[model samples]
Structures are given as structure tokens and as C-alpha cells.
Target: MDLIKTDQYGRQIGYVQGANIDFEVGADEADSINDFEIELKRWNWDGSIRYGTRVFSPDTEYGGIVREISTDTSTNVIRAKGDTWRGMMTKKIIQPLSGQDYATASGELNSIIKSKIEAEYPGLFYGVTADTGVTVNNYQFDRYCTLHAGLVKMLKSVGYRLDIRYQEGDVGMAGYVKVSAVPINDLSSEYELTNDNNMNFITDDNRRGINHLICLGKGDLKDRLVIHLYADQNGTISQTQQYFKGAEEIAAIYDSSGSERDDLIKNGIKELESKKSSMSYNMTMTKLEGNIDLGDIVGGKDYLTGISMKKPIGRKIWTISSGKEKVVYKLEGET
Candidate 1:
């Protein structure tokens, strides 16, 4: 008996012959043949365990970065051409704009509008940039309207009738933005809106990051109004609020304390009453805690930066004073 080898096609690719005739093995006789142990030689031309490859031309291939390359002979797999724009088939960036490849697409559109407007209306749209206003809550346009007095005058001069579509009320980072729209006659309406478009009379937890001014009326009047201060996103980052107390109250307290000094008990009661309201001055708040100082002393050149006041226990009184003269009141606690 002689051992035999077959290719993958079941055709007798190779076989060995013996000197003495013993038996011929049939494909169906599986149980009877048992004496031979087969060993393969390199002569068999079935295929290599480590496959070879053939070069493919570009004309026949269809894919990104098509090029002439080799392919795996065993599994018939083609090599990937390492082209820079491989994923461009699906995610392509096409535009006529300035700046980087992956920059914000809206910026390019804005540029187009600006350039077109400038060319069409030369000297008219001169400094026309992204303008932001204040409102109340986060909602659709129509809550509030805010316009820098200068911008309003400029737009009005150009024969454009504008209306506030929405605005950020609190005028802080977390506050809403006012929206504005204008009719452009034959052209489309200039429909602009901001994300902050809600009533901002009160503080919202989401808007704590916004540095707002609690306007206690100029000179500490009875009606203390808090105006949310929000700088333009593309403007300077002013992160402090100047606090000024009414001059009349301070003067009255000082006069009362001074006149009754002769009567010790009367002066003491007057002093206590005078101290009832916290001290007020033109101070700047830079941080949350009273420990952080951020402004200059009222009449002195001493810099007070990173100074914040902490509220007293049980009461919402945040006191910061020097040498018996109190300065700054934590209005956030009261508001």
C-alpha cells in the first residue's frame, strides 16, 4: 500500500507507487484501509500556507485613493491605499470660506453675508458684527430686547427697522439672550436670535456662572434694582461688580452718631441702629466668598483683589469692614 495526497478539489494531485502490488484504495472504502500513515512533501502544488499576491490595476478597482497594489492570493483581499482623504466619501467638508478645515461652519456663512453686504452696501455695514442682548429665561425668541445704544443708532441710520426677537434678561453668562429680527425688503428677513431668551428678574441656579450686578439703585435709593451684567461673548472678560451705597443714608447715620455722642446711652442706641444696615461703598466683588477681595479701597490706592465676604450665621448678613467702618454687603445672600 502507498500513501496518496489530494488537493482541495478532491482530484488526485499526487501519489506514490510501491514495487509490490498490494491494494488500491477507493474513495468510498474508509473502514478497510488502515496501514498507511501519510506524510506530505513539498512537491504538491496545491497552494502555499503563506499566500502570495498579485498586483491590481487602478482602472479595475473602485474605492478611495485607488492605486495599483497587491492582493492576497489565498483570501483574495486587496490592500488599502493609505490616502489622506479616506473618510471623505461620507464626511466631506466643502465650503467657500476662510480659516481652518474643521472650524465652525457657521463662521464661514457669517463671513459670506458680511462680505456680500459690504460689497453691495459699501460703507454701510462697516463694523457689523455679532451683537448680543439680554432677556429672561431660555425660550424661543420674543421675551426681551436689548440693544447697545450705539448699535441701535447705527442700524437706524441704515434705514433698517429692527425689533428684538429675544434676549438674555439677567445679562449674565447663564442668563437668556434677547433675539432681534429686521425686514430686509426684497431680501430675506434678518432673523437673529440668542439662546438666553427668558425673564431674568430672579437668579437661576443654571446661571450662577454669570457675573451680574445687583443694582441697588444709584446712591442706595429705596428701590434697589438688580441688573444682570453680561459682557459680550467676544468681548473682554470683566469678572467683578462695583458696589456703591447711597450717600444720603451714610451721611444721616454719621450725623446721628456724631450729634448724640454727648448722651452715651443715646449715642449707643443710635450707633446700633446705624449699624443695622451693612456698610456700603464702591467696592468690587471678585469671587464668591467674602475672604476674596477684588477692588481698590474707596479713597485709597490699596488694591483689594480676591476678597469675598462670608455671611454671618443665622442671618443673611455678610459683613466686611476695616477699623470699625464696614464696607461691602453680600447682596447675593439677600437676593
Candidate 2:
């Protein structure tokens, strides 16, 4: 892979191609900031690589600003590490003015995200766009948190993801970062990895999950609001309760501050969904076809374990070393 060096402003400085460099680039669906690291011999250093510089890989579609750089005299190697554009968002906190507890917004998800950036730190993010085409009625973000955390929480609630990329400048113009909100695609049927296809995978089935939640709301003693919610096989919460025998059943309590029955139930449902049984898979493929990416649902089946699942790609790591490349994919909810 080619590692192109650029200034902090996204202006190309130089590039290293077919060099004996080792690097790892990866992203997690649950996180706003992705990370990349580059390690190469001291002889390969162009003397221009320094702190605040940016390195981009068009082949891997991964790049980031260099926040830290270290040189090893014994090994004669140099290492540069930093985070992607999402890291920049983490530096700015969402602070609501006096008498406010949160920074709130409503309407389209894209517009809300853009407005937050423009309001908090204008010109930091350019070409803000959204392709998810999702809209939310209302959302509130806790104060004193990074903008990245706030946006991640808002987007996850609506099943969307954030993507930020650096666009190199044209001629004398300086490059800028592009921010986008995209929908998580369901490509389970289109991409399948099974033992039959000689794919290696490990399946984890966590059975220590709660199926019932007894919610207790505001008030005291018997006057307090109380409700029971059950999670079914499909992870749906409802008032209709179902009981299981022996080890097959699990239950928990959800202490809520809701005074209304509807509000309590809604809170109960959110809590219940989190406690449902988690099933995930981890697999490493040497060669794969088609365009598969993080947040895209994929299919996997392990015949030895009798496990079949369709889950979103939660994280991916790409490593290049010794003239070989390896990519690892972990399903959502996998540790």
C-alpha cells in the first residue's frame, strides 16, 4: 500500500511507495475515532514526517493526523501514530450555556449534526453531508461531553454511522475534511462466509442474558409505579410476559425515574434490549470479493458449532507486513 504524506492542511508533501513499512489501520462501528499507525526504517524517513503531519492511504482508504512520533536509535526505526478526523471532533466539548442541562436539537439528523459543528466550532468541518436520509423528532446531548461522543450517541439511536475523510486540495487550494452520516446497509444475503466455503470463524454465544425486567418507577412503596417487560426470542420487548423453567430463564430489575407508565415502559424496553443474549462471530479472510465495510450486515455460519448468524460488521483491522496483508472482521457485540 502507498502511504502518502501530507501537511496538516491536507496538502500533499510526498509519498512512499513499495517501502518496507509496517502499519495497521482500523475502525470500530461503536466509536467515532478510528486509528492508524505507521512504522518504517529511519532511512525511509523523508525528514518531513513530524508531529501534526497527516498520512493517507488511498488504497486502504485510511488516513490520520500524526499526534505522536518516536525514533528508536537501537532499531533505527521511526513510528508515527494518531487518529482520524473524528479525533478532531473529540477535542471540542459540547457546553450548553447557563441554566441548560444539555445541547438539544430536532429535525433531520444530518442538519442537526452540521448545526452542532457550526455552532460550536465553525469552519472546522466542511462539506458536511448525510446519505442515510434519516430524521429524528427530538434528541438531547449531555453537556460537558465531546462533540464526537454526542454525535455518536445521537446517530446510534437512529441506526446511522458517521464517516469523515480528508480530501486533498486542488493545485493551490487547500484540502478539507468531509463529514457524512450514512445508513448501515443490510448486505447479509449478499455476503456469506461459511465453513463450506473454507472460511474460518469463531462463534460466541453468551447465554447469561436477561429475558424479563421488573421496572420500578417514581413514588414510594405500593404507590410506586411498577411494570413488567419481557424480551422474546427476537429481542422485542412487550407487556405480555413469558416465563421459562430452570436455567433457561433470567430476570433483572430496571430502576427508572419515569412517572408516567408510557415513559417507564419505554425506559424498560431500552434496558431490556441491552440485556438480551449476544451472539457474535470473528473471522479472518485472506481474500474476499466485493465491497464490504464496517456497519454492513454480513452472514456467517460455523458448521462445527451449528451457529448461523447475520450481524453488522462492528470492527475491522487491516495489517500489512512482510509483503503480506491480513484483514480481521468482528461481528457487532463481539468483545
Worst 10 residues of 2 by lDDT: 24-33
Error of 2 at 121 (Å): 6.5
**Best of the candidates, TM-score:** 2
Residue 175, candidate 2: Cα error in Å is 1.9
lDDT of 1 by residue, 49-165 (tens): 111111111111111121223345564433322211111111222232355332211222223234433443243122234533321121111112111222222333333322221
Clashes of each: 35, 0
* Regions of candidate 2 where Cα sits further than 4 Å from its true position: 17-33, 59-61, 118-124, 129-133, 206-230, 236-240, 243-276, 285-288
Q: Where does candidate 1 stray beyond 4 Å? A: 1-125, 128-144, 147-306, 309-335
- How many backbone clashes can be found in candidate 2? 0
All candidates' lDDT scores?
0.23, 0.70
Instruction: List model 2 lDDT by residue over 1-335, tens digit each.
Output: 46778766657887854344433323342432356767778787776778878777653446667898888999998888886565557778888768987777777877777777767645545636543567876577877877877887777788776665666667755555666677767777777789777777887787678888899998888899999887777666778765443577688888885458888888788888888776757775555577776566888877677778887776665667766667666665555
